[model samples]
Target: MTRHMPISETQDAPPRRRITLPLAPPLEQRRLQLYIALLLLDGAAILNGFCIASWLYLGRFLDETSLLHSQVMLPIYWSIALSLQVYTLTALRRPNFARARAGLSLIGAETVLLFVGFATKSTDNFSRVSSLLGLGLSLVLLMWVRALVRPLIKARCGDAVTNTLLIDDGGTPLRIPHAYHIDAREHHLAPDLSDPHMMDRLGLYMMNMDRVMVSCPHDRRAAWALVFKSANVSGEIVDPEVNMLGVLGARRERGYGALIVASGPLGLRARAVKRLLDLALAGGAVLALGPVLLLVAVLIKLEDGGPVLFIQKRTGRGNRFFPIFKFRSMRVERLDSTGSRSASKDDDRITRIGRFIRSTSIDELPQLFNVLRGEMSIVGPRPHAIGSLAGEKLFWEVDHRYWLRHSLKPGLTGLAQVRGLRGATDTETDLANRLQADLEYLDGWTIWRDLKIIVNTARVLVHDRAF
Candidate 1:
């Protein structure tokens, strides 16, 4: 006969192990479906933009001599349209009302594209009025389609739960429903007692299970102690109250583990897809913008007799060092001696051309190489300088959890930048808020999320939110 050992030598006999917890299903499949849906919708928006642009510019097609008739103009218009669409999508991912934000972002994107086209002399082949009308119509149609599709998409992909274990004061087993249909099994284990041996066993069990939850009553000192020890044993312990804010949605309930189950990690496949996307987008952007980059480099040199490209050491994943590149935006004299100064809107150190590129984020184009070099991602938390503090406070003075943002690779643009958290960090509160957004993005990394940040970064840039 098989024998099970008691948790402690002091115990008279081994406690009865009456029940085996059910395994919760994995959520990877469900997350992937949502990602695929978002991609399809985004692709549709791009196609819609192109078709509308083409229809409006068809008058130029009738005249072979028109500039819009040139094959190059077609691709240029398409690229602009796609960029605009991406910008709008990114803005929509944040806190704004979805429909209104999408409309505003689309309009803003189109307006910028029009100006860029005109500046590049590409509009000579297409009628300006026709392009404007096409842009307006496309924006309206795309907004309507998004409104119609968002709920359906959310229904299909949102509210997915992975298997997690919740330990409650009563030590009863509970099952949390899966967010989406998945085949992987999950398990939940809660102990009825607070013995150190039991807690240790639970901790070991959690490490083996991949995910676990522990709940305690209002008088949770003992439970907290157990969890603290468990946390040391394994890094997977989650506070039921703090982390379940969104999931429970203000619902009150008794018993800690009532709503918890253990399932393996979800969204691994989605993460892989996002990495692949970063590689492709970064590679393509570097290739496509080579000429424009050269022109900008020349302009930077002409504007000031300094190095065309500015390189600085920035902190990235794990607080490692990497050289970040940007077109020189400040007079060489005022480059921060401490490398920790933040730029203000009216900072006098900015050069003439520097203000323009900084406002337009053209100054940041050189960092695309950083993305190619794998030192950064196309989207993530914006990196800060090593030894930088939140305002006058030292780095160690702030919450220790603040450094958790460095857990992921830094990005050229990120959730904080898109949300108007870029530019100067005037106070600790500013840095804290930015760090909060960064951590949120890290916790919820996904392909759609990255795309959303990219799109929003463009919109925010055109609007001059940083300045």
Candidate 2:
């Protein structure tokens, strides 16, 4: 018979293991439903306010004019509110923020209605006293309903609006309010990419989590980064050094901190605005530059009977590669597709028309098509060829942050190009200077700034740096 080893005498006794913690239920599905409910409630409050006001003023539940006003105001308010992020996860967690956005949206909508009414000479149709009462009551109801939903949001999302899981793997200590903390050792967890079962365990812990953050020793960060990349979640690694590296912002909460590495720099509204701008300008530029483009294509073809356009692989948004279009400037036989050779003063490979077009920035006109195709932008960091070099090293080798510039679509003319930071990068300093400007452009992007950049670009179309 098998005799169990005595606890005191045995050297191989198994230690007691802690029970695995239960995984937190997914909050995203419930949170979406809550958002829909809040939206309906807001609409109801607006309609009820207008209905009640009409009854108080005209002894009717729904005055024809008042109902019409509510209908118009409702769409306007929703449009403005969406742009202001009134219906976001942040708004759900912070009721005051939601209330403020709602109030501002209402005020803006009312102002718009007033302006339109005056412009259209329809003020007489809308009762001034009734409108005023509706506005006041709408504000009251919006605030009340938002406040009422706070507890419900809390119940659904927990204290943290996001499902945040903090995995401590023998790294820096951190604590965040309502975030699930798991000790890697206790759960027998490791970023073991080779072991399928270990990965399965990791996936279970991160299941339904909106954000998975890991604080691990420097040696393991790479493995964790790879793990998180395929995890289909917003993953962040806790690294305080990102502050020194000029991170966009920081969140300090309950002694827990993280640096946002990979995120969309532009929000939904901003992206929509930027895309609209891109389409308008790119479309217009293509039409306006049609003659110039046709002339250049004929010249390039006539010069050597070769391809009119040169397509080179360049790094684009998310560090992905895309073919960039340019008017073929070099001889077909001597073409450097890899862009390994920087065009210097009096480069022998440049054709006669190529030199003129490059200096005049006319060759870049073809990229208007790239902008229209949504592969590039009118204003952003310029994309570089994969083999492009600074000094003797590649651009990314010069600075690790070099890849960060590709976070947005490469632009025809960027802050760097407009600032006269163009041409071949002969040294590391050239890239550094341009990189600094690109980073500056990435922050606080706006339509006004983009328009300004376009205007400024025209002034630098014939810079000395252009080869």
Candidate 3:
């Protein structure tokens, strides 16, 4: 969590002036509100169209039969409209598309109403001439309302449908129309992964943006790609060869091109479900294991009169640092908080009680609190300590994809742990095996898969490599 100098600034240089650029509000965030507004406006248009038709053709503004027809037609039209994408972002952006969809929905609704009326043997519900006039007027009104709102929508949401941020990170120069651009040198913005505060600074610039495109040098592309993945944002790198590689996707606009690198794995609903599962399981485990936790705390405290819990900073979601809790399995004097030293069998650092807890994997039970705090999940890639290494190389040095695993919250137990990939990573091959499992877990996540992983974790609690 160390704070460093701004991305481009040095200690000897004078403070850089912060510049604020014009930014459009994120349209994606306000889409729900716009949809509701469009729905209400369409409803009003339908009701007024029917009333005018009733007055001109039926000699009454709001006859009971006409009112009933409008009521019956509204819900049917709405359902049809939703199915036709009449109330979506595309509808808002294209007036012609919106009008055509609205018209189609109206026809579908009228056809459904007539069929239902005939089925019920009540075909005389209203005059055919009046109904025909009402349909024609409603169609006109729908098209008028849709056309009228196009200019207003443009004024509000800008020319681009999604909010975009362009970062000029000492790479090729490019411009995205209607996108907010910031000079990395002027803003003092750098993607320093080791510094949580710097990541936070970069995150602020990306706030409310649907996509972030970085124009950085070739050397920095990997670093920026990792940053984007860890942040779980839709990210793109400016490169013409991107389309040739057939990566995620490519965006070519005007004379500039970019390659999409990262996108969020879970949607809003999926995230909500996952979070609820974590809260329910973590909360229940705390209460059910209350006695065991208490006994362990007492034993750890009495063993050497040391702290009951061992807290060490581990890399969590978004490549941020979070303190993970364990039941103080190592002696106070011998504890390796930085995790530079890996535990091994017959290690003298473990106390008598620590030996029992570490062997049984009871030392890890305290991490339920991390799950409750939303820092960890019941099943995911295990968080690695900042200084953890495989053989002589650091974990990230062994595999750059290590950062991608942090895109999701670290877990109490992971696919690696259940597959017997736990304990000391003695070599690069050991770390690579675990990293492969972690990456595989990310490909097609499902609630059922997570449940299966949790079930599998129970059988390996007392693993051979745990100590």
Candidate 4:
């Protein structure tokens, strides 16, 4: 033990420092696992519920022998269906088109499963008709449940990280002056730093930074260039046109943030596509639902005497005034007394037939013509009454970004309508939530998303969810 060891270069070197990187918090890791596990378990449970309900309903019509066979095979069918649902949930985390594709793929996979089961000469175990019914019901219920839960779960998980930096030379901070939380977090860097290189560095740094706020005047061409450069490098820029100066100097310098510069509007292609879809789908819908339209028109006229259509001035794209169309659902006398007003459930203004039509959303059928006329889209931010601008005045007055809603044609039914945001806006919170949903739809629009909204609209209408 006393023998002196010769110093070798490797052995004599200072003990190698062990760099222990910080692991994610154990609680956080456990939370993530628990959330994922819950989702999977929910999917499995929902699938099982559908299968059991289907079996119970179909069992009543079958012989005891068939019932016994179904009881054995039902669990197998549910297991397969649950697996497909899990696959769909994983795929929806990407893009809207991907989500739609995932939904269709799930349907296809279920169909294949059915065929496989049939080909195996296991037909006696489950009635072919009942199996097909179960499959259809399961797909609709599961897909809808996924859609409803996905956004909620994502919100709960804090998926959105919107910290924008507005860079502007304008003396005022770009903001909705009266609104609280107008700018989440604002900072002014240095007003005198006009050098393009300085802006570029700042922009790049802001992009690299997590959440930053920057504001510059609309006329500050240098700021635009810097923002554009930052957008190119970081690819996380959210340009919300605001009017605030000095606020641009305080822009944040790090992660997951957007640099909002005063630039001319972007996303012209999306606007154009929205218009084209509005026109085409509206025309097609008008043509397809022509007979139903005629019937509704006749019923409205017969119910209220005379005018079968009600027209009112509403805000359209870019805050422009447009006359909106609807089947006359209110008595002319009541309307005249109350002036233009939002119809409430059991509103004294609504005629008996009007109530029925409004409940069924047939009253909105005439707006299809508005889509064809290029004043509206089949799906978009629902137009609001020009006169009903109560709490929205701050948004209308100080926030130019609110005008962004008008960049596309208003819709017959939109992200708001299908998500229980259709009712009367009695409070500021309601308006904010509705507008947020609208903005989300505008930020992320795809043909598939439109189709999903359209499908959801049809479902709501059929079920009399709208009033």
Reference-based lDDT, residue 19, model 4: 20
List residue ranges in candidate 2 displaced over 4 A: 1-62, 68-86, 90-216, 219-235, 238-264
Full-model lDDT for every candidate: 0.56, 0.81, 0.84, 0.54
Ranking by TM-score: 3, 2, 1, 4
Best by TM-score: 3
lDDT of 1: 0.56
Backbone clash total for model 1 is: 19
Better of 2 and 3 by lDDT: 3
The regions of model 1 sitting more than 4 angstroms off are 1-271, 463-467
lDDT tens digits, residues 140-206, model 2? 9999999898888888888777888899999888876778887787667898754434554566677
| CA error at residue 167 for candidate 4, angstroms | 20
TM-score of every prediction relative to native: 0.44, 0.60, 0.73, 0.43
Model 2's alpha-carbon lDDT is 0.81
- Tens-digit lDDT string for candidate 3 (37-85): 7899888888888888999987899888888898899999999999999
lDDT of 1 at 377: 82
Residue pairs with backbone overlap in model 3: none
Candidate 4 lDDT score at position 320: 48
